[model samples]
Structures are given as structure tokens and as C-alpha cells.
Target: MAELLEQRSSISLQLIDALLEVFGEFNQLNIWSKVTKDDFTVKRFDLGNDSNLCCCQLTETAKSKLNFSSPKDCEGVVVKFLTFGDNGITDNGLSLADIVAVNTVLSINQISPKLLFANSKCYVHEYIKSRIYTFENDDNPEVVKCLARILAKFHSLDAPISNNAYKTSQKSYEDFFNRRKHIYGWGNTEATGQKYLKALENHPEIKEQYYDEFAKIDYHSEIVYVQNLKERLDSPIVFAHSDFNRGNRLVVKDSKDQLEKIYLIDFDATSMNNRGVDFGDYFSNYRHREDFANEGFPSDEDMALFLNEYREKCAQIFGTEFLDKKENSLEHMIDEAKIYTLGSYIGGTFFGLMWYQEAHDTGKGQYFLNVAKNQSRGYNRLKKRFIEDGTIPRILQMPK
Candidate 1:
């Protein structure tokens, strides 16, 4: 652990130096406090607020050979420093294609802190540009509606083609998740399974499920089949937020305490896939277990509200009837849940079971560990019963 902390300290220092270089001496970024997100590096700092002004989000992976794009002004305001990943990221970094996809989505969504000059002459880091407000709860109704609306509109758009750039960009982003799973699972499924199984010595229920699923996967074959299913599916390719779970979406509230404009952050996992992929991630917390980022997943009422809202938005935006089809096909929902659950089980296992101890041992504390833990637990519980047993848990039931 000492070595781990030392490594983090070194990286932290490097980030400070880069920020110092960017912000300059006068309006130097001061690290007032640090907050933890489930899957990213975040630090909250006072950007020269004697009276505690709005906080600036300086979130970019700066632990590599950081390079900058030529600076540009937004609405006549010039940002002091705007660095791009350039060629800095060795194992994982943003690709030019990813940048274009993000910029494209920002335009399509008609949302902001909209891409402030996409592919700008090497600008690496993206900022919120305005004060970001917090949600009162994870299941804040406005956020739910906003999420559904954005997703419906997004799904209505055409997906990116499998060009070289598209492949390269998506590969880089997906690899970022894989590396963590590899390292945290101690580089392999057996080793990582051991780490999680050890942690679950007390919980036999999940232990049984873990062993059962792990036993079924050929990894290479099963994953390939799933990928093939995605490729061959007749479903339309749509834009996806990828990681649409908590901490990614932020908002600003009105004077009446209602949500005004909502924005989704962290486009690292953004890609074009079947709408089911987005829906799966959207309802990640719907299964059993505890510590969901939102308030214990969406209830039947909430799901109805969301889908009703999604239906309305899709009708308006795409002129297509999505959720309320003839026979109101539950088969599609079932198929989506299968597709989503399998992926979620695999990915959530990597985080909840394998990555929890790694994050905790390395000083990430409870939130990251809990995200890793609870997500796995919830998925496992849902997978064994909902996916395998065909039992519709409360959250999974559709409105009649």
C-alpha cells in the first residue's frame, strides 16, 4: 500500500504541475478538497473564490505526456489552458475519432456545455464551462426524464459506421475498462475470480452464482457469440452514452427547485451500438442487492413514467412509435434484458468482485469499492433469477 500511495502521490504532483502550467500563477488552481467517483479521478478545488465561488471541474487523465491544443475563446472568453491527450496516453487514451463522436453527439443532443470547439488544434481536456448543479437524489424525476429523453433522441439517430477511426476510437475506450478488470482481477479470470470468491466466503448465494456463470463462459467463444449477435441484430444502430449510470449526468436546478437543463458528462465510453446496450446500462441498478447509485433502481411507476416520457419524445423526434408497439412486444424487452444482463454481469463482476479490493487497497475508499461491490451483487442476484429463471423482478416488470 505504501508503494501504491507513493505512485498516486507522484501522479497527483504531476497533475498539479500541469494545472499550474495551464492556469498560470495568478489564478492558480488550488486543491481545496478531493471527492471520489466510482470510476474516475476527480478533485474539487477553489478557483480563486474568497467567498467560495463556483467550482471548476479540471478532470482529465494528466498522468502521461500531456500536450496542448492551440487555445481558443468561447463566447469571447479565452480559456487559459486547454490540453489534449495527443499522444500522451500509452495504454489508454482518447482517439481523434472519439473526439469527433463526442462532438457529434453534443451537437445532436443540442446540449451543452456543448463541445466548445471540437478537434480544436489539439485541445485535450474538456471542461463544463459553467457551474454544474447537483441532483437532490439519484432518482431525481427531472434527471430520469432528461436521461430518457436524451437517450430516445440519441437512439433515433444513425450510428457510426465501422470505419477504421470508429474501431480505433471505440477500442481505446473499451480497453480502458479492460485494463482495470485485468489488473484488478490480477490479470485473469481465475485469479480475479479467486479474489472475489475470497471476498464472498461469507455469502454463499453469490458464490454459487459466480461459479455457475464463470463455469459457463468460454470467454473467447461466449463473448464472440454475444458480439456476433450485436453485429447480426436487425435493430438500428443508435448513439449511446455507454456509461449512463450515476455521476455521469449532472444538472442545474431552477429557482423553483426543478431541474432546468441537464448534461451528461464523461464521454469516454460513448459509442454507437444497439439501443439495448444503452438501455441495459441505463437500468443497471434495477436488479437486487443494495447501494445503487440511484434510489434502489426505478420502481414500476418510475419505469412507466420514463418509458411514457421516452415514447412521447421518440414520437416527437423520430415520428416512430418505440415502446408502445403492437402486442407491446415483451420479447424485445426480454431480448434486451438478456443482452444487457450478460454484459453487465461480466463487466460488473470485473468491477464489483475483482476491482473492489484493488481500489480499496489502493486507497480509493468505500465509494469505488461499493460501486464495484454492489453492482456485482445486484447483477448477480438479477442474473440468476431474472435472466436465468425468467422471474420479473419489480424493477423489470412493464406497465400493463
Candidate 2:
């Protein structure tokens, strides 16, 4: 037992060494105050088992050893350990993508977490003592408008990233669709499909009634059609936060300024995409992880409130000259946003499915399963409305 424990400890030390190797040595970070990795210890934060990265909060051991006067003096840090695949290559440059995104967002004076140090393997950030806003709990009218303005400013950024990796909605959807081909009933060959089936095996009704029916729709053609409509409608492409879900929207507890309270985090999915997708995706988040049968999409008044704030903010950023154009008009963008809402529904469906698959894989309890199902059902409801009401086709045929 002693020998086995020693081996485990040696492996952990080796892993930590490898993590720090990306930056050469701990002292090189410049934030260390002349200390090294051995000077302090970190406690792993329990974010979830499903994350691709691990987070560790710097503990009081460091503060005491460093003899900091107060918590605010040092402020501490959260170190994020990024994972590499078995082949010893990073996950498609996730760490670098986030670094590039952070640089761009900070350049725009956007409210993202301050990244202290980052490389391809790992990064450190000033720990935020903040709360997350969920639609079910913090869905205040004013909060919604604030989020809209934040999003508007976010989408207005035009900055260069690591490799100019910008892609259109059609292009992004094609890649995503190809990856989750099991959703289109090609699960026999797709690993994700096999796991999806295994996860939902106990709930055959969801498969027969919802999943099967959803698979019947040709999402590829549908996405292509939407892209064409988007072009005719003149929907402007912008740097999108892409995943504007509740968790990424942090409400800093210390900030009394309402304008400064909210911060956007997690820029892994940040990219150039249709502005409508960002708007539509934010609107669709109202029903995320709620009681699917009871909760509904944001009311028309609420949506109008959000959209009006967004429009006014965009006008401020782009000037009335640009917004006055046919494609940039409020009415046209609203119509375009409606078209993209369908795409958001598709995104929500897969997001829920992926979560559910992960939940099953990790042997998570029923509560987690229900949470995953709520997401799928809620977005499915939105997709069903568009289909039954012929909303997408109507939007497409409308005057551009």
C-alpha cells in the first residue's frame, strides 16, 4: 500500500510539472511575487465531472505564507488546468483560443474575467467572488435588459484572433451537424448516437415521440435554407459570445454598480457568426433547465424590452446611418432573429443531449437526468412551435 501511494504521488508531481512546463517555471508568471509552485497549495474546485478542464482555487495557505494584509490585497487566483488528448496534443487549441478571445474582449472594454497568465496547457485568473444568474431565479426585467446591452456590445467587436478563425452560421452548423450525425438517425455508426440511445433506453417514449420525430427533419437542408434567408435579410455577422448561457453570465457580488456587476466568462465558443444567432440564443435561454411543462419562452413584452435595448445599443455603436439600412433596420433584424431562433432550438436540443449523455456516463443521479431532460424538452417545444406555425417559411418569404 505504501509503495502504491508513493507511485500515485509521483504521478501527480509529474503531472503538475508537465502543467507548469508550458510556462517554463512558476516564477516566470510574474504574478507569483518571487515564489514557486511548491510555495502554495491549491484545492480543486468542484465545478463538475463533465468539464474538459479542472479548476483549483488558491487556498489561504498561500495568503498566510505570503503574509498578505487582506484578501483584497492579494485577491488570490484560480488556476485552470486544461486537458490534452491521449496523443499529447491539446484539444484543438482550446487554451490558445481562450487567450485570443480574452485579449479581444478586453480590448473592447468588455466585462470578462481578467486572465493573469495563460499558455497552451494551463492558465491562471483572478478569482471572482460572484454569483450566477439563472432564468428561473434572477429573471428580473431590468436584469434582462442589462444582459441585452451587454450582448449588443459583445457582438459589436471586430478583433483579430489567433488564426482569423471566423466562420459563418452555415459553416459552423455543418461542422456541428456532421459531428452529431446520430441525431439524424445515423446513430448506428456514430459513437455519440450509441451513447445517446444507451442513455435514453429507460425512457422509450422520449425516443418514439420526440427524438424520432425530430430526427425526421432534414436539419442540414433546413440550416442551408436559413442561411440563404439570412443573406437575403442582410443579417450582419459579428463576433458572437456563442454560448451566452446563464453560467457564463456572472454577477459580481462586490460591485454595486449595476452596469459593472455582470461579467461574461468562458470564451471557448467565441467566434464570428450571425448576430441573430446570439440574440436568438439569449432569448431561448429563458426556459433552460426549468420545468419544461410549466415554463415558457420569455413573454413578447420581455422580448421587446430586451430587443429595444439591443437595438438602441447597436445604434449607439454603429450609428444610425448603418442601422437605417434595409438589412440593418430594427424590423428586418427582428425578422432575421426569428429565423435564427429555429437554429438556436436545434443547438439547445444537442446541448441537452450531450449533457444527458455525460450524466449517464458519469452515473449521475435522477435529478441530473431530469435537469438534462428539461433542457431538451424546453427547446423541443420551441422547435415544435416553429414547425407547426410555419414561422421560418413565413419569415423567409417576407420582404427583405
* lDDT leader: 2
Q: All candidates: CA RMSD in angstroms?
A: 10.7, 6.5
Q: Global lDDT of each model?
A: 0.46, 0.57
Query: Candidate 1, which segments miss by more than 4 Å at Cα?
Result: 1-94, 104-108, 118-143, 158-235, 286-301, 321-342, 353-361, 365-372, 387-400
Residues 138-186 of candidate 1 have per-residue lDDT tens digits of 3466677786787677666664433333355346425644664465343
Instruction: Evaluate residue 323 in candidate 1 and report its C-alpha lDDT on the 0 to 100 scale.
Output: 48
Best by TM-score: 2
Show how many residue pairs clash in every candidate, following the order shown. 4, 0
